[model samples]
Target: MTESLRWIKSSYSDNGGQCIEWAPEHANTHGAVPVRDSKNPQGPALLFPAPQWSHFVEYARKQSV
Candidate 1:
Protein backbone atom coordinates (compact mmCIF):
# COMPACT_ATOMS: atom_id res chain seq x y z
CA MET A 1 0.00 0.00 0.00
CA THR A 2 2.93 2.28 0.55
CA GLU A 3 4.39 1.77 -2.90
CA SER A 4 3.11 3.65 -5.96
CA LEU A 5 0.78 5.84 -3.94
CA ARG A 6 0.72 9.54 -4.81
CA TRP A 7 -1.14 11.80 -2.42
CA ILE A 8 -2.13 15.40 -2.95
CA LYS A 9 -4.04 18.08 -1.12
CA SER A 10 -7.08 19.94 -2.32
CA SER A 11 -6.22 23.05 -4.33
CA TYR A 12 -8.48 25.12 -2.11
CA SER A 13 -6.28 24.41 0.87
CA ASP A 14 -4.57 27.39 2.44
CA ASN A 15 -2.12 27.89 5.32
CA GLY A 16 -5.07 28.66 7.59
CA GLY A 17 -4.74 25.03 8.78
CA GLN A 18 -7.94 23.55 7.25
CA CYS A 19 -7.19 21.15 4.46
CA ILE A 20 -8.00 17.77 2.88
CA GLU A 21 -5.58 15.38 1.28
CA TRP A 22 -6.42 12.49 -1.02
CA ALA A 23 -4.65 9.70 -2.85
CA PRO A 24 -5.92 10.00 -6.39
CA GLU A 25 -3.51 7.44 -7.72
CA HIS A 26 -4.85 4.76 -5.42
CA ALA A 27 -8.40 5.65 -6.30
CA ASN A 28 -7.70 5.43 -10.01
CA THR A 29 -6.15 1.99 -9.81
CA HIS A 30 -7.99 0.33 -6.92
CA GLY A 31 -11.35 2.08 -6.92
CA ALA A 32 -10.86 2.87 -3.26
CA VAL A 33 -10.57 6.40 -1.97
CA PRO A 34 -8.03 7.49 0.63
CA VAL A 35 -8.31 10.68 2.63
CA ARG A 36 -6.08 12.14 5.31
CA ASP A 37 -5.05 15.25 7.17
CA SER A 38 -2.61 17.67 5.60
CA LYS A 39 -1.12 18.35 9.03
CA ASN A 40 -0.35 14.67 9.58
CA PRO A 41 0.95 12.91 6.50
CA GLN A 42 2.07 9.91 8.53
CA GLY A 43 -1.26 9.55 10.29
CA PRO A 44 -3.94 6.98 9.55
CA ALA A 45 -5.86 7.45 6.31
CA LEU A 46 -9.59 6.98 5.98
CA LEU A 47 -10.33 4.59 3.15
CA PHE A 48 -13.67 4.51 1.40
CA PRO A 49 -14.88 2.67 -1.65
CA ALA A 50 -15.68 4.67 -4.78
CA PRO A 51 -19.44 4.81 -4.27
CA GLN A 52 -19.16 5.83 -0.66
CA TRP A 53 -16.70 8.55 -1.53
CA SER A 54 -19.02 9.93 -4.18
CA HIS A 55 -21.95 9.99 -1.79
CA PHE A 56 -19.91 11.63 0.90
CA VAL A 57 -18.78 14.42 -1.44
CA GLU A 58 -22.32 14.99 -2.59
CA TYR A 59 -23.65 15.19 0.95
CA ALA A 60 -20.87 17.55 1.94
CA ARG A 61 -21.57 19.80 -1.01
CA LYS A 62 -25.18 20.24 0.05
CA GLN A 63 -24.28 21.43 3.51
CA SER A 64 -23.67 25.08 4.34
CA VAL A 65 -20.15 25.91 5.43
Candidate 2:
Protein backbone atom coordinates (compact mmCIF):
# COMPACT_ATOMS: atom_id res chain seq x y z
CA MET A 1 0.00 0.00 0.00
CA THR A 2 2.91 2.34 -0.64
CA GLU A 3 1.35 3.58 -3.84
CA SER A 4 -0.60 6.80 -4.05
CA LEU A 5 -4.16 5.90 -4.95
CA ARG A 6 -6.43 8.12 -7.02
CA TRP A 7 -9.81 7.04 -5.83
CA ILE A 8 -12.74 7.55 -8.21
CA LYS A 9 -16.27 7.68 -6.97
CA SER A 10 -18.78 5.34 -8.54
CA SER A 11 -20.73 6.89 -11.42
CA TYR A 12 -23.97 5.64 -9.96
CA SER A 13 -23.54 7.61 -6.79
CA ASP A 14 -25.75 10.61 -6.15
CA ASN A 15 -26.13 13.33 -3.53
CA GLY A 16 -28.31 10.94 -1.54
CA GLY A 17 -24.91 10.03 -0.09
CA GLN A 18 -24.26 6.27 0.25
CA CYS A 19 -21.39 5.67 -2.12
CA ILE A 20 -18.20 3.76 -2.86
CA GLU A 21 -14.90 4.65 -4.38
CA TRP A 22 -12.29 2.54 -6.15
CA ALA A 23 -8.71 2.89 -7.25
CA PRO A 24 -8.79 1.99 -10.95
CA GLU A 25 -5.24 2.89 -11.76
CA HIS A 26 -3.98 0.55 -9.07
CA ALA A 27 -6.23 -2.19 -10.34
CA ASN A 28 -4.99 -1.75 -13.90
CA THR A 29 -1.37 -2.22 -12.86
CA HIS A 30 -1.72 -4.55 -9.88
CA GLY A 31 -4.67 -6.74 -10.83
CA ALA A 32 -6.37 -5.91 -7.57
CA VAL A 33 -8.93 -3.19 -7.03
CA PRO A 34 -9.16 -1.34 -3.73
CA VAL A 35 -12.64 -0.26 -2.73
CA ARG A 36 -13.87 1.79 0.19
CA ASP A 37 -16.83 3.70 1.44
CA SER A 38 -16.71 7.30 0.34
CA LYS A 39 -17.87 8.39 3.77
CA ASN A 40 -14.74 7.06 5.45
CA PRO A 41 -11.65 7.97 3.53
CA GLN A 42 -9.33 6.86 6.32
CA GLY A 43 -10.95 3.50 6.85
CA PRO A 44 -9.61 0.22 5.54
CA ALA A 45 -10.31 -0.62 1.93
CA LEU A 46 -11.18 -4.07 0.67
CA LEU A 47 -9.15 -5.47 -2.17
CA PHE A 48 -10.69 -7.59 -4.87
CA PRO A 49 -9.03 -9.26 -7.80
CA ALA A 50 -9.48 -7.18 -10.95
CA PRO A 51 -11.41 -9.77 -12.92
CA GLN A 52 -13.66 -10.67 -10.03
CA TRP A 53 -14.32 -7.05 -9.24
CA SER A 54 -15.22 -6.38 -12.88
CA HIS A 55 -17.62 -9.30 -12.94
CA PHE A 56 -19.24 -8.23 -9.72
CA VAL A 57 -19.71 -4.71 -10.97
CA GLU A 58 -21.16 -5.90 -14.27
CA TYR A 59 -23.55 -8.14 -12.41
CA ALA A 60 -24.58 -5.40 -10.11
CA ARG A 61 -25.19 -3.05 -13.01
CA LYS A 62 -27.37 -5.60 -14.76
CA GLN A 63 -29.33 -6.39 -11.63
CA SER A 64 -30.06 -2.74 -11.01
CA VAL A 65 -31.23 -2.13 -14.54
Candidate 3:
Protein backbone atom coordinates (compact mmCIF):
# COMPACT_ATOMS: atom_id res chain seq x y z
CA MET A 1 0.00 0.00 0.00
CA THR A 2 2.79 2.41 0.87
CA GLU A 3 4.57 1.65 -2.40
CA SER A 4 1.57 3.05 -4.22
CA LEU A 5 1.90 6.42 -2.52
CA ARG A 6 4.18 9.06 -4.02
CA TRP A 7 6.59 9.82 -1.21
CA ILE A 8 8.96 12.78 -1.41
CA LYS A 9 11.73 13.94 0.83
CA SER A 10 11.93 17.42 2.20
CA SER A 11 13.77 19.79 -0.16
CA TYR A 12 15.75 21.01 2.83
CA SER A 13 17.17 17.54 3.35
CA ASP A 14 20.81 17.91 2.36
CA ASN A 15 21.52 14.24 1.95
CA GLY A 16 21.74 14.17 5.69
CA GLY A 17 21.80 10.86 7.49
CA GLN A 18 18.46 11.75 9.02
CA CYS A 19 15.56 12.59 6.78
CA ILE A 20 11.77 12.54 6.63
CA GLU A 21 9.50 11.79 3.70
CA TRP A 22 5.85 12.68 3.22
CA ALA A 23 3.16 11.89 0.70
CA PRO A 24 1.29 14.99 -0.38
CA GLU A 25 -0.84 13.02 -2.81
CA HIS A 26 -2.12 10.90 0.03
CA ALA A 27 -3.06 14.01 1.93
CA ASN A 28 -5.03 15.35 -1.00
CA THR A 29 -6.76 12.11 -1.77
CA HIS A 30 -7.19 10.73 1.73
CA GLY A 31 -7.46 13.93 3.73
CA ALA A 32 -4.48 12.77 5.74
CA VAL A 33 -0.74 13.19 5.33
CA PRO A 34 1.49 10.17 5.64
CA VAL A 35 4.92 10.75 7.13
CA ARG A 36 7.80 8.37 7.67
CA ASP A 37 11.52 8.25 8.21
CA SER A 38 13.41 8.11 4.97
CA LYS A 39 15.83 5.64 6.47
CA ASN A 40 13.01 3.29 7.41
CA PRO A 41 10.78 3.11 4.38
CA GLN A 42 9.37 -0.22 5.45
CA GLY A 43 8.62 0.94 8.97
CA PRO A 44 5.37 2.26 10.27
CA ALA A 45 4.05 5.62 9.07
CA LEU A 46 2.41 8.41 11.01
CA LEU A 47 -0.83 9.78 9.70
CA PHE A 48 -1.81 13.37 10.36
CA PRO A 49 -4.96 15.17 9.40
CA ALA A 50 -4.45 17.58 6.51
CA PRO A 51 -4.96 20.65 8.63
CA GLN A 52 -2.69 19.36 11.37
CA TRP A 53 -0.05 18.44 8.86
CA SER A 54 -0.21 21.89 7.34
CA HIS A 55 0.24 23.42 10.76
CA PHE A 56 3.16 21.16 11.47
CA VAL A 57 4.84 22.12 8.21
CA GLU A 58 4.27 25.81 8.83
CA TYR A 59 5.70 25.46 12.32
CA ALA A 60 8.73 23.58 11.07
CA ARG A 61 9.41 26.15 8.37
CA LYS A 62 9.30 28.93 10.90
CA GLN A 63 11.67 27.09 13.20
CA SER A 64 14.24 26.90 10.41
CA VAL A 65 13.98 30.60 9.75
The CA lDDT at 16 in model 3 is: 77
Residue 53 of candidate 1: its Cα lDDT? 92
TM-score of 1: 0.79
Off by over 4 Å in 1: 2-4
Report the CA-based lDDT of candidate 3 relative to the real structure: 0.90
| Highest lDDT scorer | 3
lDDT of 3 by residue, 1-65 (tens): 68888899988799776998999889998899999999999998999999998998899999988
Better of 2 and 3 by lDDT: 3
lDDT of every model, 2 decimals: 0.80, 0.87, 0.90
Clashing pairs in 3: none
Q: Write the per-residue lDDT of candidate 1 for residues 1-65, one digit (tens) a residue.
A: 63356888766567677886888888888999988887887778889998899898789778936
Against the true structure, what is each candidate's TM-score?
A: 0.79, 0.90, 0.93
Give the Cα-based TM-score of candidate 3 against the true structure: 0.93
| Candidate 1 clashes between residue pairs 3 or more apart in a chain or in different chains | none
